[model samples]
Target: MTTAVDTRQVRDLAVAALAWVSAHRGDFALGADALTADGPVDLTWKPLGELAQTCVSVRRCTPPSDPLHACASDLLDFAWQQTGRGELFLRLQRTEPFATYPLEVYSVFAGAGLRHTGYEVAAGAVARSRGWRLTEHEPTRRLGLLNAERRSGIHRPERFAQALGRTWLGGLPEPWTFERTSGYALTHVVFHLTDWGRTAQDVPAELAAYLTDWLPPWLDTCLDAGMWDLACELLIVAASLPQPIDAATLQDPWRRIARVQHASGALPLMASDPARTHEADPEPSFVHGYHSTLMLAFAAALTQGVPV
Candidate 1:
């Protein structure tokens, strides 16, 4: 029987991947600078394709042989400072040699400050520490036809723990994996400003969209519904609105992607079609956070037009 891996080992493996990618920031054979203002890394923003490329590159470069060796080691040391001895690895074996990570993921990470100080420092740390173990809850059966269609080969998402010594303000996790965490924090800043009676112009365009399209419906469905964790997703989306939010009430912009679950357990937003929703996924929370953050960021960009 194949042995299931432990969480710490998985963490280490993940750290290794981030190190490889970080050290190889300019090298796609491991890590290539993922974000560029004008275009995709490979000039094609396809994530599936990028994964294929990344897998091939990583497989080809071993720890000792790769120039990123020292960088990777350094990252691990940093990681150990936070979480201790985590193991990480790709969910899939490297096979296709030509695939590269899509620029969007890289762009998203970079735009969100994945590598800079106070950025997702946990990219390496998480990959180094975290705890987990397997348990048998139910029988499993392979999805042959469905799996074939999704191209969803089994590659586990890179997960990890906070490194030990590094302390961020307000006890926030570094390199937050889900965009929702960061988005919500940013959103609260905007909300308090808006609720406290701040001017719309004071806000960023990145957050503007949410003021209309995202806010009301989110409040309608998420708050009214009992699903609280998903609420985090909604808060994050709020962060992406642009400056000078358009005059809009909370109810106007909901695409009504799912049924609203207010006052009870039913969520209308949840029932809506995924494609029609702002972001496509099992839950709209993540998509909501993503779009909100993006819109707010765009608003920040508009400031560039002004004479500094």
Candidate 2:
């Protein structure tokens, strides 16, 4: 049976995590050389992508009344100013393996930022052309292309609908076996299906049912193994379902993660031995904690329906 989630506790944790991110924003910022008269540009795309997503997550999870709301908004503005105009700039210098990730990240962040904050940054004709070229040249990136379309309000419904018809949620490998790739792919699929949960009907009934049934066990397995990042992503999937998972089902993982969060507000990549921190960086590295903390904030925001 499901029980009640301690919402106050969840809010406190999110606020703390947001505070930690606010304090460390510079650590996540692009180098000084990346800034330009037009705005910040020439960013290191990967970290900027991560930071963008982090800003979106926090923004989605906090409310105007909440103190973190202003901070999230500021950080997002900072991120957009730094990288928004640079979409085409980064594309020009793109390298393999990292190529598609930055585009997808920028699209997700830009789209969600617009949705939540009414903040607009034009990707321009060059970026649009780049998206089409990437889509045509990289057939596997159909989802990313759709995301870019949806965010930019380009309205290619037929293409998105066609892609949805072919999606096979059950065909995905179990989280335990495929680990990182499988987990990330599933999260992306859900994000697209729900349009980041803006349209509940967009989530197909079959996919929603599959997640409703499987997510609990999958979440437990990841938590048991101390895969905090995957566990957090699973929580996001659970939050996005049409029939939302019971908050009680998420309570244990939430509390465990909260417990493991360092006083600095950064969560370790896994449940770590205290002795290990002494040997490495004194604080949990931002890279180590970013996704999990960001997702935790997202889960709290989505589950609670904090006003965008």
Candidate 3:
């Protein structure tokens, strides 16, 4: 018999597993957790080399009316699960959950009202992960399942690199991350996306306000290179977290991309510079950008309130 919580968890995990699979088609395959016409799928954050492998049935989980391989609810679940999974969510989203799922995943919903289902699942998943009852260190266990390529791993910046042609120039690369530079922006997004509960009030008004305005940069990564998917996700996350910034900030990322007037399709992907860090030692820089930014921004917003 399914308890209310158990029933909710299955539905929630169903969506989470779906989003996890789609967003990380490569990782899911590496982990061999991709859902096929088989039975139940077993998954871990790590790749199954030998002991990790498991036999399973495959099943195609899809809707007949929907041709899109992925769904919004699953993406939403993925975002929520990432947040719940803490750093995994940070690594996976590369921006923020709320920004990614509701804003971008709507295409999967096919214009249907996905409001209730998505919200319910997202809230449930996060509560489990971020709940006060759980210790802060709880998420580190996922680190155990991590693969060696954290440099080249899914956690590495630019795991989702896209190469496309530009109008005059022909071809260009759009990278997703910058070693030490993106920390402030990343943390601001993560802090806002978190459930600070009523305690956010304890964080001070000035610091809170900076988190609002300072986020515009993540939306404006580079003038020519752009990432609306990440921007929308940042926006969705901002809205879900109920930040001070308005939807106007969300428009900046898309606006920049739209205004570019590129003859070829815009190449929107993670930032990458092999010389810089995020890839060298995944441990030091993983969420360091966001973490440091949040702390510094809070201090500045509270005391100085300057970009520094």
Per-residue C-alpha lDDT of model 3 across residues 25-130, encoded as one tens digit per residue: 3333322222222312233332211111100000112233432223533333443333232332233333333222222222212112223334334423433343
Off by over 4 Å in 3: 1-27, 30-204, 221-237, 240-244, 257-268, 271-308
Q: How accurate is candidate 2 locally (lDDT)?
A: 0.60
Winner on TM-score (2 vs 3) = 2
Error of 1 at 234 (Å): 1.8
After superposition, which runs of candidate 2 have C-alpha atoms over 4 Å from their true positions?
A: 1-3, 32-43, 84-109, 112-141, 155-158, 164-178, 272-282, 306-308
Q: Which candidate ranks first by TM-score, i.e. highest? A: 2
Candidate 1, 1-308: lDDT as tens digits: 01121223222333333433343333222222222333343432332223232322222223455433344344333332221111111111122111222211222223212223221232223222333112111110011111111122212242111111121211333433324334344343443223211233544353354344545454445444333334423432332234322223322222221122121111222334433334333423422322222221122122211111
Collision pairs in model 2:
none
User: Which scores better on lDDT, 1 or 3?
Assistant: 1
Best by lDDT: 2
Runs in model 1 lying further than 4 Å from the true structure: 1-214, 243-308
Per-structure clash totals for the candidates: 73, 0, 27
Is candidate 1 or 2 superior in lDDT?
A: 2
TM-score of 2: 0.75
**Which is better, 1 or 3, measured by TM-score?**
3
